[model samples]
Target: MNFSQIAQLLVLGMAPLGAGSYALCRAKARPERFGGAKFHSPSWYYGWYGFLWAFLPPLLLAVASWILRLAGLRPAPDWVLMALAMGLGLAGLVYAHRSVNPELRARNSVEGVIHWTLRMSSVLSILITVGIVSSVLFEALQFFSQVSLWEFLTGTSWSPGTAFLGAAGRETEGVAKPLFGSVPLFAGTFLITAISLLVAVPIGLFAAIFLSEYASLPMRRIFKPALEILAGIPSVVYGFFAAITVSPWVVNTAQALGVRADYTNALSPGLVMGVMIIPFVSSLSDDVLNAVPMSMREGSYALGATTSETIRRVLLPAALPGIVAAVLLAFSRAVGETMIVVMAAGLRPNLTWNPLEGVTTVTVRIVDALVGDQAFDSLETLSAFGLGLVLLVFTLILNVISAYIIRRFRQKYE
Candidate 1:
């Protein structure tokens, strides 16, 4: 059946499920005089039990049919499949209603179903992650077959212009060979990330301190939400603000100081990205600071410490681990950011320390390589996956470190 027809059938199917639930619930909730023993579970458990029975049959059928289709075999006609699904659903509903009685452990049955569902979800997520890693690794191997891993990792140049011709089996010996040295890309990525952290960390940490330790409740409520609202703004919008507003301002300011700066300087995107990452640091840091035991603060105060002294001596140390984790998480976020860098930071793979010079990140280059008309098997195209693998590894390391730090912090605090 078509989408609307299938939707209507599914919606109609829910009617019976809802009716069965309400009927079974009301029946189970009757006075004890009507039954021998107390009801094993609440009335809602029966309702949910019936609902699951009504829903699961059709969903499983649909999934089975989809899998069959993917295997290049048609199991049945759409109408026949729909009929079978509905038939099984109705049968399940009838069976559920018949099974629901005073002696039946409805809660145990429902909880078992829920537990398995959660377990299956976890397994599915792991499978998806494995699949992604496998695909990227396989493609990266293809790219590395043509480009040396050592050169890709250690070389500084990143020109892949002639790689497409090489992929198409053309001679490219005399012409300039494609270089896939990822050092410049990684360097740019780190430079921008570092600049962003410089802008975000201090401001975010100070904001968190004010909100958690110093601000009044009324001011905290207003300012915290306002600060978080910055995170809600889209990256593209931030990129636009950086490009249109921040970039030119940086250029003009640099010129005023007798320093030459590119319009697409690294500093502008870094500053803008830092603003974007402030919420990640501030929100988590504030929570960590607040979670510090009140007794620590009181004890510090009793020791004749001023508020600043108490914060520095007691609260800061207490929350340091969590704050570090927040900063690391924010750094990971800054590393992976694409649009802000794409728009504000020019796509020049410049290996330099100057923030005023234009630089491109791994993400931007990945986007550039994929968006072109180059063949998929081209070294340039496959290079995206190689870059992706590096990015993924870096991100995973940061996450692992963050998790370890948080675990250590919790063990100490809790």
Candidate 2:
């Protein structure tokens, strides 16, 4: 049987053990025990105390067995593991039931268990993040071993058409040089991201400024949710809109203006992606703007400052940090978007500044590599990890810059 089935059986066994132990403990906490002596904790705590003791040991043993098996050590069969967990759980339940009495600190024990459970859950979240980073780094290391970091980062060409699964199969291709250069992919990704930000930041920020400073209570109530509705709409719908509606419009508009444009231009997806990210910037900026102390605005008004000037000088400076953060977040969202780019942007990685032309992004190529009958050990497949690592680093750098800007703004605002 698989690990999940074993876990299900063990959980099923522990449930009965806990119920019986809790019933026994509650019985012991009755008024007849110790001649109606008052208990330190409630009867419920004593019951839960039994429940925790009954479950923890079995859970630990099962986890240990799974870890051992993962480490290439033969632990036991599924039945044996289940039997061991069940036996220990029953033993622990009986002991826990017997140990509970009027003098026992059952409430403290239960509260401590609750606290530790929360602490472990938080730790587990951190560990999961670390594990993901480590796995990506490891795979990227393997990919870089085959392709040099210099070529991957600096070289321009990025076609990894058909890669063999192993070095032994290299002879079939006769020492064929594989180009893993990522400059075009990076260029395309940044081109779309920049266009997305250009469309998102000013429009969203101005919308926030209007909502916070100009709009009345009823207007705020109506417009805020209406604007946020943009965020809730599915990306696939946006992708279809970009492909069908926005792409053609762009092509025709450019043609009417006597310029050439492609059907799958970068501008279409970037514009749609920007519309999707607008609510993020607007919502966060609105919150930050509203949080800027009302007294500051009132003081500026007392000094005969107009609303526009006060907003420009006082509110914007105070709220610059959060606004920067929101813009950076929108930029990241645009860079990481997949469906819209796949639907509206071309697959060809074009390294040009013109948004009128078609371009592909890192996410598009990553999806391209893994969607087909790609070999697990192939160069194309492994390049996805390398792309992911580069994206991770780029995101980290953006976060660092945001943090620095936030800190500097806070120093001045405070």
Which candidate comes out best when scored by TM-score? 1
TM-score of 2: 0.83
lDDT by residue (15-132, candidate 1, tens digit) is: 5665675576546554464456678788788878887887788877777777777778888898898889888877877778777778778899989999999999999999999999
TM-score of each: 0.94, 0.83
- Against the hidden true structure, what lDDT does model 2 obtain? 0.88
Model 1 clashing-pair count: 0
Which ten residues in a row are the worst by lDDT in model 2?
164-173
> Model-by-model lDDT, in order?
0.88, 0.88
Model 1 alpha-carbon miss at residue 293, Å: 2.0
Report the error of model 1 at residue 233, Å.
0.8
lDDT of 1 at 386: 94
